[model samples]
Target: MTDGDLDATDPRTLPGFFDALADGKLLGGVCTDCGQVLLPPRPACYACGSRAVDVEPQSREGTVFSYTEVHTPPPAFAADAPYTVAVVELADGGRLLGRVAADYSDVAIGDSVELTVHEPTAAEREVALDYETDWPVHIFEPR
Candidate 1:
């Protein structure tokens, strides 16, 4: 399907997100009712319960709102046992949870970051995103 056909309501919607990711594009679901934007497109508007939504393009830069270093990873991520994850505030005011593309010791809550997309190895995907993803995963590196 085409990017124009990406639907937040489809059962394959999450996979469609990967499709966009593979294309070096980031997508967010914008609620028509409450004007809220969410990453990893949800089925309905969290604010106003609107099923009417639009698939929107997202900015590539953001600031970290919160972050944590993971030292003890699960088996899937044992290969890269230590990493940093961050809650980033996207330019559109949407927050995304993603790997911080930096050493764990360097990440901070207020750091400015820009997007980097990676088509990771199976192990790296699991380590970074907690998913053995088939498409590129998003990372935020210090700007």
Candidate 2:
């Protein structure tokens, strides 16, 4: 779909991105102008301020760029506290932040990982807004 035709149902939008994720596909926005990759496809390129972005399939493989453990989470996620979260640099050049299946002590910079998607848990859905209840959760698994 063209940028001008973007809507909540468009892949460039969060809902659409998760919809594709639910089906096991990873989509990214490639900047036609500067080759920048946007992780959850957007209508415009953040690096070049260009609207010439195209949605395309992206590789699930990536390496840990950075990470941390959350010892204190919001009430909704208190049961899941002390989880590892990380910034992974994908094979296609897009960097995405997501939960890591490994523990903080097990993950390190440059560790290989692969993106994995799953339906949101009941607890997650409980905290999500109506429009986000159906969005899938993405995690990075050690590869």
Candidate 3:
């Protein structure tokens, strides 16, 4: 998708992004100006402040850039305290933050991982806003 098609109804939007994710496709925005990749396909590039972002498929493969264990989670995630989370640098150049499917003890910086998507659990849906209730949740799995 090109910049001209980036509206509230396209993959650059949350609903459209989740829709594609639910179908197991990962899409990101490639900056025409500086080649920065934006997860969830935003209309503008955060790196160059350009409006030349183009939506494209992205690789699910990545490596952990940074990680930490979440011992103190928000109320919505209280049941899942002490979970592992990380900022993964994707093979396609986009970096995204997500829950890691592995334990904190099992993951390290530079660990290979793959992104996965799943429907929100009942508990997750309980805390989601009306528009986000059906959005797919993404997690990174150690590979």
Candidate 4:
């Protein structure tokens, strides 16, 4: 699909995510009723079953919870294969999964890291997250 085809509404939609990314921010959802944090924020709380979720800014800081290096990605993301994918536990107790920009050999469980907003290049547009920024690609860097 073309960049123009990207949808920017609702966090669940790519377009909305990209809109935040273009602004260099990582947005997540929080349960207004229970104070539960949700990464990749949803409209409802998975824990308390509440629909009173609120948009909250997530901290870029986190620790590697788990990770794997994929030698092959699905057809669409084949180019990013052999890359490290990680589940990051944020400072606020939420978790998110994203690509680790660093070399897989350098990754370690529990490593400190911060969020980075990556800009979409033409080649990366297809699999680009809606949250990418116009600024430099954001990666979790060592603290």
Clashing pairs in 3: none
Tell me the whole-model lDDT of each prediction, alpha carbons only: 0.79, 0.92, 0.92, 0.74
Off by over 4 Å in 3: 1-8
lDDT top scorer: 2
- Relative to the true structure, candidate 3 reaches a TM of 0.94
On TM-score, the stronger of 1 and 2 is 2
All candidates in order of lDDT, best leading: 2, 3, 1, 4
Q: Write the per-residue lDDT of candidate 2 for residues 1-143, one digit (tens) a residue.
A: 34577777788999888899999999999999999999899889989899988899999999999999999898998999899999999999999999999889998999999999989999899999999989899999999
Q: For residues 1-143, write the lDDT of model 1, one tens digit per residue.
A: 13344454342278777778778888888988888987877677788877777879889889999998888988877776588899999999789988887987887778899888888776665556444356677788899
Could you give the C-alpha RMSD of every candidate to the true structure, in order shown? 4.5, 1.7, 2.1, 6.4
Could you estimate the TM-score for every candidate? 0.83, 0.95, 0.94, 0.76
Candidate 1: stretches off by over 4 Å: 1-12, 124-133
lDDT-better candidate, 1 vs 2: 2
Q: What is the full ranking by TM-score, best candidate first? A: 2, 3, 1, 4
Please write out the lDDT profile of model 3 over residues 30-94, one tens digit for every residue: 99899999987878888989988888999999999999999999998999998999999999999
Evaluation by lDDT, superior candidate among 1 and 3: 3
